[model samples]
Target: AQSVTQPDARVTVSEGASLQLRCKYSYSATPYLFWYVQYPRQGLQLLLKYYSGDPVVQGVNGFEAEFSKSNSSFHLRKASVHWSDSAVYFCAVSAGNTGNYKYVFGAGTRLKVIA
Candidate 1:
């Protein structure tokens, strides 16, 4: 069975500070990892993803993630975060090869940015 874990339930950071949201996954084979952000009352939006190739991939905004097979992790990072970046961050994993490409999402980590 595949699973996703986000150790932190919530994180508070000062505005303009660097941010790193940890994510870990468990899967037998290569996994399609993704990072998504959900606003208060909006759908989850893709922040970054790692399918294949380069371990590090750039995403929208100043976000980026590095995939580590040995660690079974795909952590998201940002050089500087703004107040608007406050949201619930979710780490998800999907095994496309499996008969059912169902995605398992982590509990979620709420980010609070303060001035």
Candidate 2:
């Protein structure tokens, strides 16, 4: 069994500041790590994925994450965040099952950017 967790339920940040979101996972085998962002009611967009080699994975919209095997964590970071970046971020994990596999999503961290 594989699972993902995001500790923070909400984060408030000033616009143009550095930001980071936490993630942790529990999996017996190597799992596919992913970060997704949801603007409102739309489907989640893949920010990045960590499957095999690289520990540090680069993502879209000026975001990146580091995969730590020992800690079982994959945390997302952004050097500078915009007002538009204020949204719900979800961490997900999937076992390598291609046939009708499902991704477990975090509760979500609502990022509120203040001006």
Best by TM-score: 1
- lDDT string, candidate 1, 45-90, tens digits: 9988888999999999899999999999999999999999999999
Error of 1 at 52 (Å): 0.4
Q: What's the C-alpha lDDT at position 60 in model 2?
A: 95
- For the record, the alpha-carbon RMSD of candidate 2 to the native fold, in angstroms, is 1.5
Stretches > 4 Å off in candidate 2: 97-100
Clashes per candidate (backbone, < 3 Å): 0, 0
Evaluate residue 14 in candidate 2 and report its C-alpha lDDT on the 0 to 100 scale: 90
Models 1 onward score TM values of 0.97, 0.93
Worst 10 residues of 1 by lDDT: 94-103
lDDT (tens digit, per residue) of candidate 2 on 23-102: 99988777889999999888888999999898999989889999999999999999988999989999999987654388
